[model samples]
Target: MNNHFKTAMDQVKAEEALILRTSSYLKNVENKNVRRNHFLQKGNQIMKKYAVAAALAVALIGGGSGVYGYYKIPVNYLSVDVNPSIELGVSMSGDVVEVEGINEDGNTVLEGVDVIGTTVEEAVQTIVESATENNFIEEDGSSVVSITTETDSDSVSEELTNAAEEGVTQALENENVEAEVIKSKIALDRRDQARELGISPGKLNLIQKLQKLDSTVTVDQYKDAKVKEIMKAIKDKKKEVKADLKEEVKEEIDQTIEEGKTEIDQTIEEGKAEIKQNVEQKKSEIKQQVEQKKSEIKQKIEQKKAEVKEKVQQIKAKNKNNGTQTTVESTTESNSQ
Candidate 1:
């Protein structure tokens, strides 16, 4: 009975040891499964992170390319050119007349009457009639009266001289200033006149004088010395008047010039100020534009980042079930090439 009891105790001990060994083996298998699951979770997290990073990088590259393209677009430019030209002519028309005679007082007098007419023929007839009626002819047929008309030429100089003498004689009689007719000449000395008048030749009143014969003076005298003396006196008086006028004009011109210079300087300064203001305004505008573009680019980049993040999340979810996939598609569907 004692030996049987000892053998039963040994059998119990062996069964207990076997049970402990089985429990230990099960615990180790559970630990290995837990480690494997943990490793898989970590790998999934790493793949998701890589996908997010790749999408972000691609989006950044695309956004950068878009910005580069936007900047590469050109703006239009413009500009203008200017050029600037003058023209200058003269016109004339009129008739002539002749007169000659001695009055009852028997003073030797020769006269030519001009019948001032629009037509040359009528003017001549009127002049002859007037001379005959006034008994101003010596009745010599050789002293025949004639009428002539000229336009735009120096050929009328002789006729003009005669007319001037006659007119001067008539004027003398009218003024009751005794004067005898000798010689007359219609002289046009632009340089001399301009020099004597102390004015630009363009400013001279030559055109005004040409418009009316009454505006001009006719010199009538028998003695050349007397005429010269009279001309000298007239020239001296004109010179004195011109000198006085020039002095006054010069003073006024100087005042005007000074005022104009002041105005110009002020205008220039104001223009500079305005230009500076405009430049500042333009700079501000440019800054605003740049800032606006930067904001737009930043928004676009952020949007792209968000899109990339979303795509990465989608890829992560898809890869969680189907694993990651890389696809490349290329098409060369050319009609000619």
Candidate 2:
């Protein structure tokens, strides 16, 4: 019995060792799974962070291109000339992308004027009003404002030109400024030529017009002249040309009227001569017809007189023969008694 009890205790000890070994194996497996899951979750989180960063970079690049495209490109160009020449660059949405003075006077006018990102109308008004204040536009003297525009399409050019004209007029009126606003469109090539000469396109255009009216005028001669002076010269030249043309037309009209009167008088004289000749010819023909009728009546009367004389002589001869035959018959009867 003692040997059996010891064997039983050894068996119980062996079973307890097997159970502890199984529990230890399960705990090791659970720890391994927990560690693997932790690693996988950390890896997933790291990948998500990389994906978010890449998406943000793409968005910034795309948004940056859009910003550059809208704000950087210029779609139109314009210039204002009032003895102070200023040029402007316009964006696609009609904002003033750039403003620059082309000369010393232009710079003076643009001093402290900030027009970027403003509408073209507002920019134009501000510039013109500033010029007025600076005495570039005189209150007691008349002045001219020339606004020129250049663009890819005629419609846009006209629209911008009209807007500029309105803006200038409104500003001048508001300040009680006495000035004339002239609007025009400048071609691209002409604009470049104006830039080369260091003049606004509006001034260049006016100079060209002045040259046309007065052939003696040169572009360089009036390059530094004021716009008001150039406009006055043009006006005077036009008036002179108009007066000369009127005199020439009057002389031509007088000569034409004289020639027409002479032709009419000569035609009347020729008609009178023809009518007199026709009347004389008709009278001569009527007189000859009357003389012929008189001669035919005289010849008929002479023929009737000759026929009556022959009949009278035959009757006298017949009477004498009858009387002689009666006398002979009476003598023969007496002899027989």
lDDT of 1 by residue, 1-337 (tens): 3698789777765577898998897777776466434432432233334435555565587764543332222110000000000000001122222221212211121134333222223332333334334443323322212111111123333433344345434533443334222332222354245336432222223222322333343322211122223334445656766898999999999999999999999999999999999999999999999999999999999999999999999998997655322221112324224
> Model 2 clash pairs?
none
- Candidate 2, 131-196: lDDT as tens digits: 998889978758888888976456567667877888898889878878877888877678889889
TM-score against native, each model: 0.27, 0.62
- Give the top-scoring candidate (TM-score): 2
* lDDT (CA) per prediction: 0.39, 0.77
Q: Which segments of model 1 are wrong by more than 4 Å?
A: 1-241, 324-337
**Model 2 segments beyond 4 Å from truth?**
1-70, 212-216, 286-337
Each prediction's number of clashing residue pairs: 7, 0
lDDT of 1: 0.39
